[model samples]
Target chain A: AQSVTQPDIHITVSEGASLELRCNYSYGATPYLFWYVQSPGQGLQLLLKYFSGDTLVQGIKGFEAEFKRSQSSFNLRKPSVHWSDAAEYFCAVGPSGGTYKYIFGTGTRLKVLA
Target chain B: DAMVIQNPRYQVTQFGKPVTLSCSQTLNHNVMYWYQQKSSQAPKLLFHYYDKDFNNEADTPDNFQSRRPNTSFCFLDIRSPGLGDAAMYLCATSRDQGGYTFGSGTRLTVV
Candidate 1:
């Protein structure tokens, strides 16, 4: 079965500092990868996705993620984080052939310090 | 904008009472999913409707039921509320191989 792992449970970063959240997955094929963000008391919002061509994908709110096939990692990065960017981050993997089901990782709680 | 919308941002029900949470979509996606998210946990798939074909997860209890009257609407029904069932119920929609659009979710409290 497919699964995802986010090694960090909590990360605190100063505002305007660079940030990276690590994610790794287990899948047989070239998996569909995605990053999502969830604020308190709110639903998830799509951050970015890696489908086929580009190894690096850009997403909403100045976020980007790089898909590294060899390492089975798709880590999220932001050059300058904002205070409002504090939230929970989730990494998910889905099958490529058209199944919409996704296996999500344990979330990483991000705390942006001023 | 095309989006998924869930009703009653928050709900409170007594023990053993029946409660229903509603979800509607304007995206016209064929797949609608229900997920249960407890505090500090990832969302767990409960069931989904693929254009009226219901698919339930093996571990999903019989106390939970769902209804999809049409492509635009889906409902999650809890037959008997329990303390353990108190969690955020999230509704989402997606096309095959496409990213999901999620609603704000309904927070349920079993009193």
Candidate 2:
């Protein structure tokens, strides 16, 4: 079974500071990776995804993630995070050959300090 | 813009009462999914409809059922609400594009 792990349960970062949220996955074959963000009292919104060719993928809200095959990791990063960016983040993995089932990480709570 | 839409942003029901949550999409995607998300937890897949075919997860309880009347609409029915079933119900639609578009979600409260 494919699974995802977000090592950090919570992370606090000052506004305008760079941020990184770590994610690792265990899968037998090449995987499709995704990052999603959920604000309080709201549903999840897709941040970014890595499908095939590009190891690095850019997403909405100035977020980017790099897929490292060797490490079985796809970590999300932003050069500068805004206060509005504070939310819970999830990392997910799906099988490569048209499998729609996605295994998600527990989540990482992001707090933005002014 | 094309998007997924879920109805009744919030719902309140008594324990053991039946409740239904609705979702509709304009994206015309072949897949629609229902997910249960408890407070601060990752969303768990309950079931999905691929076109007209229904697929339920192995662990999904029988108390939960779903209906996808057509490609544009899907409904999740909870036969008996439990305190543990109180959570956000999310609806999503996707294609082969590898990304899913999600609705704002319906937050359910069981009293």
Strongest candidate by lDDT: 1
Please give the DockQ score of every candidate, comma-separated. 0.83, 0.79
DockQ of 2: 0.79
Q: List, residue by residue over A5-114, the lDDT tens digit for candidate 2.
A: 99999999999999999999999988888999999988889998888998999999999999999999999999999999999999989852355778889999999999
On residues B68-109, what C-alpha lDDT tens digit does candidate 2 reach at each position? 999999999999999999999999999854678899999999
Question: Which residue pairs come into collision in candidate 1?
Answer: none
Q: Taking the tens digit of each residue's C-alpha lDDT, what string does model 1 give over B1-111? A: 989999999999999999999999999999999999999899999998888899888899999999999999999999999999999999999986687889999999999
Candidate 1, TM-score of its B chain: 0.98
CA deviation > 4 Å runs, candidate 2: A96-98
